[model samples]
Target: MAQQAYMTETDNQGSGHEPRGTRIRRLMSRLANRLFAGGRDGRGIWRRGMVLTALAVLVGLIMLLHAQVPNTIGNSGSLIETFLPWLGVSVPVLLVLALVRRSATALIAVLFPAIVWLNLFGGLLGDKAGTGGDLTVATHNVNADNPDPAGTARDVAASGADVVALEELKTSAVPVYEKALASTYRYHSVQGTVGLWSKYPMTGVRAVDIQLGWTRAMRATVTTPEGQVAVYVAHMPSVRVKMEAGFTARQRDKSADALGEAIADEKLTKVVLLGDLNGTMNDRALNGVTSQMRSTQGAAGSGFGFSWPASFPMARIDQILVKGIEPESSWTLPETGSDHLPVAARVSVDTSS
Candidate 1:
């Protein structure tokens, strides 16, 4: 009996008498051994991990340093920036590859690009709908060669937008649009190929020179129930990508500069610019205007809201920009008879503020 008791006591002492720090050290040692344990070729596993880590870091750098890319090559920097959100797709691809390889290093590396992409465009992915605003404004580039002008006009008018701006308004189809919109918009102003139709009274209507030699832009003041808001409509010269000349948008860039100067000189506090800018907001060619105004679509829309080539929209060239007004919501309307879709934004103009 004595020997049995001694043996039990000795076993208990051996199992439970170790110092807490010693036990913790032993546990950590086992974990480390397990984690570091690898296949027969340990170096190959580490090499793979290093490669994935490098790839992940590259992804993050590409997104964060995209602006450093030169625009001289067909304005490629702007083109990339316009589709910056797409870079996030690579993160998931890298993650899947990491899971397939079972590399902890690659998995850890993916966090960098994921965080970088989210930091760049996370806000844009969220739901942006808020309370409706005091005024809803819409814009469309009614293709100059539209097959059905009356149908296009009717579609736009049906939107019931308080203010509508139409660009690329051809001379032959002007009357059709006028007749179609006259009932809803009693106050209208047409300057060259651009026009503004308003539900409220309009004043200070005049053509604004965009250095385009012709009247392709106009500005007006609309006296709505909420307040007087300055409205400017423009159709920037089209840009083209040629094999020899690369991205040829010199004319559009010059026009943008002139438009910026015009807006800067305006005395009004509240302003909205609606038109086919012919360039995305990311394009440096439109930096003059983009710097001075906030894009309604970017501020409140649910998505990129590309409006060009209604059949297969690739970029959002049509824009609704505002200054001294709060955008409540923004969206793109369905395809009409025109080649381009309509874009709209609702803004709150708190005149008292």
Candidate 2:
């Protein structure tokens, strides 16, 4: 009887002197057991990953209601919209986490973002390009500090674009560009930091004001075989993101408004705009310009024709937009010495219309 009493006392002492880690493990095991009850029909589906489920739901709502997000704080709405397509990345990640935790609730919540993302971007995955077009146009932001202006001109000329627009033109490099492209393009004009070269006859070329006090945009009439088209070449003011100021793009936004007004006033029925807009088509600040026009890449390009930062393109800031011209094919040109890769599009202008 004494031996039995001694053994009982030893057992009590061991329980009281258990290590902290051991005690934590025991507590966690009990909690996990309560969370995941064994059952053949997945009885504990609703009891897991409460935090993960909440996060997944929030991500889905953010994607679904992104436009409603206010820009009062640091222009967060524009920033979000600029990279809106990337928001889909969270869906697959959340799904993986849900599967690992056997969380039915989180898995179901993840579907919200998945569906919303597919609805927005699914159409972009297919090849919509046609085989024929009457005119081909291209645009490039030949970096102001490009090392080889002549070679860059030759590269764009090789694309066989009937009309080409170059932005960020340096005063010194204008002659080099003109000389290199002179052989292929007979008509050309340069105004401030932007220029346009065309195989067809060009007239009525003039600098357009975008409220920067100097010319960064221009409009010209190109007489193609089909008819006359008013082409606009613009290099919108660059935008920056700062820790103190957030997305600093008020100037760009103003310029876009002015540019939109200018386009709205054009006399010609067929219009094509090309340039480095410095913002994605999804950015709301550009609504003044985008609302009335259509993107060639969106209409005919096979993929997300991201054309900026040639080394690692993440956005299609360089664009070809149209009011009446129909896009047949769209694509990006090979990398030049400049920072941005040139974008090209083939468009059909019906003669009978």
Candidate 3:
């Protein structure tokens, strides 16, 4: 009987059976450990992915908004083109974020602003070199307060421009400019605060209403060797500075719109617009003009070509725009007595077009 009992006890131990309650507890403990491990790993991955996605979306939104703002406002001091190059930075940053997160959706979203920005400013990035027949034209803002009109006229004549357009012309300096430039240009006319001097025959010269008193803008026909071309010289209203309102950009914007409408209605095919625009090509307000006409400097110049306040030029307020002409080369000339530097261009009149 003792042997039987001992054998039975050993068999029960070797069978590996525990009380039901203990077995259930052991199984539950194992399951809880597995569940906790899985939850921890999942949470860590989710957090990392969320952080990366949020960063990408945030950067992309900022870039989009920045690209949408119109560069020019009434009296805004900053030029629009200065901020155009920053879009390039945004594109790369978004691309890097997309790669790091491995988010295909975010990568796709980045293309919207990238395309818009490039479409508007892509031409500025490429090489602007091209060949065409030579037709020299010059544009300058002579500054109403210019002290040395003779010096300014002499400098303008030195540029070898076939046509010269002057802005901010004051009555006091008119005689000096007339005397200095008289020997070079055979034809000249002053409508209001602006004037045009040309080597070729100028006729049908009349003032254009650009919202300034009298005649701040005028159009003339230049009989060149190739053909007749219409040239417009304009000096838009000066943008005022005030502490109450950030740059009063509305007036300039309205003028630009009106000017654009006028230009669009003109019967002439070949047109050249020269002046101190008080804004740059990248400014959205100037889109009224910039969208219709091609800027010679932007097409063929080597650098940013900033031409305003010549002593420390931060913006290219002075400009030469061409329509129905192929620009070959463009550059800024040495400073004269005026506050703005002269911008010159060599263009080819495409009469065939």
**lDDT tens per residue, model 1, 17-51:** 76789789999988755554465676443455677
Candidate 3 lDDT, 262-284, residue by residue in tens: 78877789999999888777666
lDDT of 2 by residue, 34-58 (tens): 5455457655868777888999888
Model 3 misplacement above 4 A = 1-67, 70-127, 351-353
Q: In angstroms, what RMSD does candidate 3 have relative to the true structure?
A: 12.9
Report lDDT per candidate.
0.87, 0.91, 0.77
Name the 10 consecutive residues with the lowest summed lDDT in model 2.
34-43
TM-score of each: 0.83, 0.87, 0.70
- Residue ranges of candidate 1 with Cα displaced over 4 Å: 1-44, 49-55, 101-103, 351-353
How many residue-pair clashes does candidate 2 contain?
0
Candidate 3, lDDT over the whole model? 0.77
The Cα error of candidate 1 at residue 108, in Å, is 3.2
> Between candidates 1 and 2, which one is better according to lDDT?
2
Model 3 TM: 0.70
